[model samples]
Target: MGSANVASTLVYMAERCTSMRYLKLIHAHAYRTCLHQHTVVLGKLFRFVAVSPFGDLSYAHNMFDQMPHPSTFFYNILIRAHSHSTTPSFSTLFFNRMRQNGVAPDEFSFTFLLKSRSFTTPFVYDTHGAVFKFGFSRHLHVQNTLIHLYAVGGVTLSAGRVFEDALKVGLDVDVVSWSGLLVAHVRAGELDVARKIFDEMPLRDVVSWTTMLSGYSQAKRPREALALFQEMRFAGVWPDEVTVLSVITACAELGDGEMGRMVHRFVDENGFGWMVALCNALIDMYGKCGCLEEAWCVFHRMKRKSLITWNAMMMVCANHGNADDAFRLFEWMIDSRVVPDGVTVLALLVAYAHKGLIDEGIRLFESMQRDYGVEPRIEHYGAVVDMLGRSGRLQEAHDLLTSMPIPSNDVIWGALLGACRIYGDVDMGEKVIKKLLELKPNEGGYYILLRDIYVAAGRTVEANEMRQAMLASGARKTPGYSWVEA
Candidate 1:
């Protein structure tokens, strides 16, 4: 490569490479090569590296501090990097600094700023005035980004306004624009809207079909995703890995083995049987749909088994109430040199917990980190906690919560709160209940737990208070029922 190209790439990597280590190596090498001596060269270099792995707010501030008069070009790069950076306060800091620096903000600069604030709906509106201040509301990429922000934030109407504007500008709307809108439609649970978008696609690519399929799956419209799949097949759109995954998951949800078997045939005929994910999904589909034999067949037929494959089988066994088979499968999985994930241990512990073998459950739960080196997620914790709760070791369950490295979330707290009511430990139950109410104020289960705890403690007045709170907040308790093929 020429010296000019090398210098340019050095600038680009500094500005764009997300990995910190790679950026540092490049930075070190360029420093040695004197590629960073030129002010223009170093300025571009710092901008590209702004969001790289080693980049922090200090690095950006240092760059700006050293420059005599940082232009919009410099601030734009800094602002853009801040968008991808980990700190929100830093973005706010830089936005405040932008006005003080007397640097004129550009479209790219504002777009990233708006994107950084996209998580909060009200904060996003604040960025809108700034976008208009920079006069970039009409830019196609800027508008499209806003549409996506709106769609993700669950405001389909606001999303539509952006899409309509994109059309008015005759700004060649691509599949991404359509896909984003479809996702928003899907999130709204408007399957008809998703279907309309699917039909209106003048051109449907893999993502276009995949989006509709996923939308159908999410909204519990598996049949529609399946129909779209059939249409995709007829239209000769080559199904990628995602298409097969959606179809398999849809078949699983349908719980029709005969239908699942047909999908199996289609998958095999398409020569996708060798794909690990497809195999995993097929096993899951057949297992859940009561075709355990087919699931085992698909699992064994795979040339290689992934950790997910083993974990999926374990889950299937546990779900079918075949705890013995589940444990045996876990043993085989361990012998086969696969490092188990949190799912595997949790499934095994749950099986043991169900059988009331508290010792076995405890052993496996402890072994998760000790033997497998896999850190337990809340699912793993929940299984063990529920085990202890059901077995009437309420204090032990509470102790587990105390011992956890992280604070309990709603599900964990809810389980313990449920345990308190079960064992009639009103005081501890109230403690869990208070935490739940404080953390997840809107969770209906907290009120239900509060009432149940009061009732268990024979405090009728407190129970009435909880009921009144539930009514006042309009928090409906989720059904605490489960079906076991009864």
Candidate 2:
């Protein structure tokens, strides 16, 4: 074949190469045709093996090592691939080698390096310096990546400076630049500032809208998040899976089942129903909305269930007081070879807690670290304590609290205190209140709870004394409010 035809044929075959074995055959063919030495041919082959689903990084590395003169493009492909790998530090190592080989690093080189998950503050600063040295500090893509790196590191000031510098230099900052700045403020919990920036953006894409929505959802402003979703739709911006996930989470928080159903229907109609993450979010939304049947329907319809999917369904059952179903799901999860993580075990423990299965709950709690290799967290301890307290096992619950490896928090102490009032154990109540006071001396609610306990126990003198103590402490009881969806 002619050289031009040979190169075209090799490029076509390389594009269709599905497996490493097939790729090797193509490489061997290129070698026999004497085109393997061509940089373009090698670059094509290297890119496929470095990034394709069936590609092998180790094999790509070998090919790179054999190249007589590797280009910046070759270095970039490897660096980008490694940036998402388990050891993202390899991305920097490749960059160092690229510099050593005298291959000029482009904006993409710095962009991928800044994206490395192994980034520390010092590493980020070092990269920021390199960006300036390479004169790529002005490149919007590189600048945006630096913004994300700074934001994630909680350096909102530095991130803002990068964005401002871009604007000062007339860099034509786009949606990504705005989104990166929004993320910086959002990560710092400065949602108001983020919203102002979002509003000020000359143009907003799905990413800009999603980042703002996620910030609101994560900051526990679910109502605002939903309102923004309405605005997003009205602005004619189609929601991606990520956008829908945040909206569903907001709906879950508000317990707005009607809104959840609407989001679910949108997912189905807009071709987002196939995403496992969206399905998982839908299950959680339905579960929190007290729509167990709807949660179950979503669960059963999923063809591929992740560990999170099972945990969400199990928690749904547990939340609705369906302990038996939760247990059944656990068994089925085990049969399906989906190993239970901390969340899965926590869901089962929550089930035992709600059903008042004291023995079962205790057994599971004890075996958590030993059997499932999942160490119990504070939430697990809290669930078990709440369970024991509910069953009037105040002493046992108190003992568990004190004996826990982690220090007891007000919620655990409060659970035991509430139990003491229920069983009219004045002595235990006094003891629990003392511990609670030590933790939260100015908490008026704890004092009020203790005063109520004293009144219930007919200890009028102590009740009067507690009332005086509450007034003297100057601690105000937080007003209670309820949410009613209109």
Pick the lDDT winner: 2
RMSD of 2: 3.7
Per-residue lDDT for 347 in model 2?
91
Clashing pairs in 2: none
| Poorest lDDT segment (10 consecutive residues) of candidate 1 | 477-486
- Which stretches in model 1 have alpha-carbon errors above 4 Å? 1-40, 51-61, 120-123, 168-172, 256-280, 297-310, 332-346, 349-486
Model 2 regions more than 4 Å off: 117-121, 335-337, 369-371, 471-476, 480-486
lDDT of 2 by residue, 361-457 (tens): 9999999899999988888998888889889888898898989988778988988888888888889988998899899887888777777777787
| Residue 136 C-alpha lDDT in model 2 | 91
TM-score of each: 0.63, 0.91
Score residue 431 of candidate 2 by CA lDDT.
Answer: 93
Tens-digit per-residue lDDT, 337-372, candidate 1: 787888888788878876778988888788778888
What shift in Å separates residue 153 of candidate 1 from its native position after superposition?
A: 1.0
